[model samples]
Target: MKLKNGKMRKMMTVSLAATMALGLLAGCSGAKTPVSNQEKVLRIGVLYGGNMDDSYFRQQYTDIYEFDRKNVKIEIVPAINQSDWRYNDGSEPYKEPDYLDGMKKIMTGSNPVDVVVTDVSVLKQLIQENMLKQLDPLVQEDKFDTSDFVPAVIDGIKDLGEGSLYALTPSFSSSALFYNKKLLSDAGVEPPTDKMTWDDVFNLAKRLAKGSGKDRVYGFSFNRYMGNDPFWDMQYTYMAPLQLRMYDEKAETMTVESPQWIKAWDTISNLVKEEVIPNNNNVNYDENWTPISNDMFLSGKVAMMISESYYINEIADANTNAAKIKDYTPVDWDVVTLPTHPEKPDIGGNIYLNNTFAINTNAPNPESAWDYIKFIAGEDWAKLKSRSNSYEMVARKSYIQPRQGLSYNIGAFYNIKPVPPTNPKDDKLKQEKRGLYYVENLGRTYFQEVLDKKKSSTEALKDWSEKGNKMLQEIKLNPKTEFQEDGTPYIPEDNVSAAAGLSSKG
Candidate 1:
C-alpha cells in the first residue's frame, strides 16, 4: 500500500497521511424484534482468527454491544490455541494440514460455537460442501430488510453459493492513495488530485524525491506484498481497471502474456531500476523487521502510499504511542483518488472484501447466531463502528460517510468501482496451487533482477511472459482433485529462474 514527488533539501519528519479502501459502525433502534430467551448465550466460533478473543472482537462487542448485557451473553466458544492461528504469507507458504479441524471440533465436539467468522474463501468451500445453514429462510421469516446493504457485497455473498445467501460482512477493507501534504508543499508541487494518472503520480514522485546516500528519500513506495499475488498485482494495476482476468472462467483457460499485463510489468520494472520505487528491502526496513508500512509514511520517510482502511486506526495508535515519549506534532496528510490507467480513466480502485460471517450447518443455536450476525450488520453496529476509525466500512451505503474529525478526501474510498473476483476457482488457484506466491515470486525475481542491473527490463519482461505463460497453463489445468495438501497439483518449485537460467529464491 504507496506514491510520487520532487527534491531539494533535508527535511523534518512530519505526520504523514493514510487512506483506506473499507469501513462500519452505527446504532439501531427500529429494525428487529426482541430476542427470545433461548438465544441468550451466543457462542461464536471463528474459523481463522484463533481464540475468537482478538482485540477486534472484544472492542466491537464491548463498545458496540456492551458486554454483560441483561438480555444476552456473548461467548466465543471452542477455545483455540495461542500458536495455532496461521495466516500464510509468501515466506511461510499456504499449508493447512488441519484445515477446518478446529471448526469441525466445534461442530462435532461437546463445546461448539453457534456462529463462525472466517474468510470468504473458506466460507465458499463450506457452502459447496453444504456445511453452512442457508440464511434466506431466516431473513424472510424475520422480514429482515437488507436493502440498506451495499448490493455488490450482498451479491458477492450470494454468488458464493450459486444464488444462496450463506454469509455477509459487517464491514470490509479497502485500498487508496495517501499523500504527505507537507512534502508536496516543500517540493513546490501541488499534492496529488483525485484524478491523477499513473504517469502523473510517478512525475510527482520524481519531483518530491530528494537528497543522496543515507539521506536519500525516494519519490514513492508501496505495500511490500503487492507483487506477490497475480490477482492482487493485477488489481493494483492496469488489468483490474479494465476488468481483465488472467484466466477466462467461462472457457477455463489461461490468458497471460497480454499487452496490458506486459506493459504494466515493463513500466514497473523500469521504475525499480531507476529507483523511483523502493524495493521490498527498503519498504519493510524497520529495525525490528515488523510489518510497519504506515510508520514509513508517518515518519515522513516517503511522501505517498497505498493502505487499507485499518491504517487509519494505526495512524491514531502510533501518534498516541509517540506522544508518551515526548510532545510530537502529527504530520499533516490527506488522500486523493488512486492513480488511474490511461486506458481506463473512469475506473479508480480494485476493492476487495476481507472478513465475513457464516453459520455452522450443525449449529445448536442458529437463531441466536443469526441475531448476532444481524446485529453486527445492522444500522446500530455501523454507527458505533464508524466512530472507531478502524477503516472498515459497514456494508451499508447510508453508513458510508466521512469521519467526524478527519479532513482528507473520503470520496476517494468509494469513488471507483470494485474489481470483483473474475472466476469461481480464483480462490482455489490462489490457495490449492499456491498460485499467488508462485507467479508473484517469479515476476518479483525477474523484476528485481532488472533493478540489480543483472538484466535489462526488456530482457526480464520477455522472460517473464514465457515463464509466466507456462506457469499459468499448469495452474489452469491443475485440478483440486485430492484433499491431501502435499500431493496437490501445481508447477513444481524450481531452483532457478527459467527465463535467465539463474538460481532463484523459489
Candidate 2:
C-alpha cells in the first residue's frame, strides 16, 4: 500500500488546497505585517509536484473553506512537474525525482515556500534533513486533539520522527484479508480472523478449496487483479510481512539461500503443490468472462484474498452489474486484518499514509502553516472528506465507517499496527538497489521450478543466489551493464563506453 501519488492525490488536490488557505489566515502569530494592514500573502508549496495553477486552486479552495479573505491572500508557489501524475500504473518507466535537491532549491531561494503538501516518503526525507518544523509544540499550543487519529498512522509517524511528530496526514490506505462468507459457510470452513499467520491462512484456504476444471475453487489469491503472474503476486505479500529481502544488509550479497527465505519458498511451494493456491497455469478463466469478471473471488472461485480497501468499490460495482454477467452473482464477502506472521503478531505490512502536510522550518508564516495542518487533520475536516469516495480510510477513525448500509467490518483496514521499521538505514539501501529489483523477476522462474518439484526449495534458492550474485557483481563493475537471460553481463554494442570488456550484444 505504498501511496500511489497520482491516484491518491487526485482526491486531495482541491480540498488540500482549501485546507492550506483556511489554516493560512486562521493562525497568524508568525505572519508578516502588511504595509497597509489590509492583507498578507501565504505561500504554499505543492511538494509532490503537479501543476498548481493559481486560479484553479483558488476556486476549489474557496469552495471548501470559508474565511475572511479581505485581509489574506493565498498563493501557490510554482513546482517543477516531478513525475507523470497521470500514470500511476507501472506501464511506463518511472522517473524518481530528487526531492531533497528540489526542496533545498525551493526553500532556500527567494520567495521560499512556507507550507508543503506531500506524501509520507517525502515527509520522512524532510524530517531526516531537519528541514520541517516539529508539530508537537504547535499541537500542545493549540490544544489540538489527536485522540481520534488512526492509532497506527500516528504511531508510525512518531516512530519515524524518533518519538516526536513532524507531519500530519488526513487519510491513509490499507489492505485487509477479505473472505467469501458464502464459500466458507457452504464448505463448513471457519472464516479467517485478524492476525492469523501464513500457515493458518494456507490451512484455511485448503479447507475452502474444492472442485476441479471450470468449477475449481482455490483457497486464496494474493490479489484479485493478479494478471499473468499469480506466483509473484502471492510471493510479494508473504515476502514483505515475513521480512524477506533479496540482498543482505550491505547489498553486496544475495540472501535467498538463508534459512528464513528457504522456509518461505518451501511454504509457498508446498501450498501450490497441494492445490490450495492457484498459479498462472492452474487458474481457470472462461472465454466468455469479461475482463473484470476474471476476478476469482468475485466469480466465487476463490474463498479468500488480501487486497487494499479500494478493492471494495470494485466489489460493489460488480454487485451492481451482476445481472449483466451470465451465470455470475455478487459475492458475499467481509474483511479482517491482513494475515500476520507468528513472529510479528499484530503488525501488518499494508498501511500507507498519503497527502501528509508539514510546515517548513524556514517558513515565513509558520503560524499560518501550522493552522492549515491542524485544520485539515481536525475531526471536522475528516467528517467532510469521509463522505466522499476519495479515500479508503480517513486518519480520524470516527469518520471511517462501512459504506452506508453495509455491515461488514470496516475496522479491518486499520486495526493492526504497521510493520515497524526494520532498520533506519534500510531506506537508503532500497533506493540504491531499486534497479536491482529485477532479481525478483529472476527468482520467479526458479520459484516456479520449486513449485513443479523439478528442484527442492534449497536447491532452487542456491541457484537463484548464485545467479543473483553474478548480476550484482556485473552492476557493481559497470553501473550501466545490462544482463543476458542467463544472468551474465551483456552490453549493447552501441554503448561502447559502458562495454567494460563484457560480451557485446547487437
Candidate 3:
C-alpha cells in the first residue's frame, strides 16, 4: 500500500477485534514428527471468525493450519453454517439456536472436529460446554515455554473454572486515533496530542466538524467491527478510554448505570446532538461502494476516527481508488495516540487478540491439535505473521515496529496497557453462552433511544440496566453458571506536549 509519504507497504493486517497468520503452512511449524507413509492425517476444524474473506483465518489456513509436513498429511474442515444465523456482533439473538446447534454438531458429531481456528464467542461457548480440552497437560507434556506469550493473550482464553488455559492467540489487534490534517488546520484547531484527554479531543472534534447534511464533515468514526461481537467498540473506544466498563464482573453486578458510565453515554449523546459525531443512522454507505461510505474515515467525511491499523492499507488504497473516480480528492491524514482519560493519561485503548486458536476435547487427535495450536501461536509463526499486511501487531514484541517508512505514529499503538475484564469469569461465560446477542439486540435498543433523543441518557441507561439485570439474573440461575476469578492499558512524555511531538513526526 502506498502512503501519502509515497512509501509502499502491504497494510490492512487487521480483522480481529481487527490482524495474524501464515506465509504458507509449510515450514512455519517445528512440531512435525517423522511418520511412515501410512501416517494418519490430522483433521482441523476452522470456525467462522471476523472478516473471513480477508482475515487472519485466510492467512493461517494457507500458512500454518494447512502447513505441510513430510510424514503427516493435514486436512482442514472449514466450518459450514447450515443456518443463516451468523454472529454479527450479537445483532441477532434468535439465531443463537441455529448457531449453537450447528457448533454442537461440529464438536460432537460422528466425525468430530479437532483443533479450531475461531472467534472469541465460539471459543467461549466451547469452554462453557466443557467441550474443549484442558491444554495445561499438553503444555506440560510438550514443555512448551509459554512465557513469551503476551499476558493479555493468555487472559482472553481463560475458562470459567479456575480460569485454566484452554485457548491461545497468535496475534494482537488494537486501535489508534487517526486525524485529518486538513480538517484540523481548516478549523484552526491544532492537531491532537498523544496524551490529550477525551474532553480536549472532543472539543477538537467539534471544531473540525462542519458543513450541513450530506457534505458535512464528522469529527470521529471507526472501522466496522465484527458484527458477531459489536459492543466492543463502545467499550474499547469509548468507555475503557475513560477506565469504565458496562459490567463489573468482580462484583457480580452491572456497572452500566454508574455515574462514569452515564457520563460516557452522555458524552457520546452530546457529540451526536452537536453533530460532532454523527449517529450510526447518518453514516450511510453507497451500495455501489458499500463499506467505504459507511467507513467515514476512508470516505474522508470524518476528521478523526478510532480505527485499527488495518486502515493503514485501506486508506492508502482509498486514495488510489478516489483518484480513479471523478471529483474525489484523497484524504490527507496521519495518526496519533488514542485519547486517554485525564486520570489515566498514559494508557492506550483496549487491545484484542487475533487468530486465537483452541482444541476440541472430543477430537480423536487432541495431541495433533495441540501441536498445531502451539506451532501457530509460537515464535516461528510470529516471525512471518509480523511481516504480513495485518493491521494488528503480532504478539511478539520484536515484531511490533512500524513498517519501514510510511509516517504514522506506530509507537502510539504500543504506548498503553489493555483494559481487562472486571466481571466474574462465570458471568463472562453466561453472556457469551447466550451469544451476548441479548445485550446487542436488546440493550442497544435503549441506548439508541438516547442517541435518537427519544429518551434522556439517564432514563435510557437506567431502563436498560434494569432490564439487562433481569436477564442476567435468569442466566445465573442456569446450572452451568459455576466458576471463579481471574485477571485483567499507555503514554508519556516531556512538557512539550506529546501531540505536538506527534505532529512534528508526521
Highest lDDT against the true fold, candidate: 2
Q: Write the per-residue lDDT of candidate 2 for residues 179-253, one digit (tens) a residue.
A: 999999999998898778778888899898889987888898787753536456655567666667778776668
Per-model C-alpha lDDT, please? 0.59, 0.70, 0.60
lDDT tens digits by residue: candidate 1, 1-506: 01101011112222211211112212242334344444366677664344544555555543344332336666665334444535444565335333345556776666567787765655666788788899999888877778877655677678778988988787765667888788889889888888788888988888878765444566766642322332235345545566655445432444544776667766666665565566554343434333343355776667877776556666666565665533244667777767887777745564555557778788877766776677767776666555553546777778777554556676676566454444324543454555544554566666667656787656776676666565555455442222123223333344113322422422
lDDT of 3 by residue, 133-182 (tens): 88888788878767766554565456333578887777767667888888
After TM-score superposition, the amount by which residue 123's alpha carbon in candidate 3 deviates from its true location, in angstroms, is 3.3
Cα-based TM-score, every candidate:
0.65, 0.84, 0.64
Q: How many clashing pairs does model 3 include?
A: 25
Structural RMSD, model 2: 5.2
Task: Rate residue 483 of model 2 by lDDT.
Answer: 65
How accurate locally is residue 312 in candidate 2, as Cα lDDT from 0 to 100?
A: 86
Which model is ahead, 2 or 3, in terms of lDDT?
A: 2
Write the number of the candidate with greater TM-score, choosing between 1 and 3: 1
Highest TM-score: which candidate? 2
TM-score of 2: 0.84
In model 2, which regions exceed 4 Å deviation?
1-38, 51-95, 226-231, 420-435, 492-506
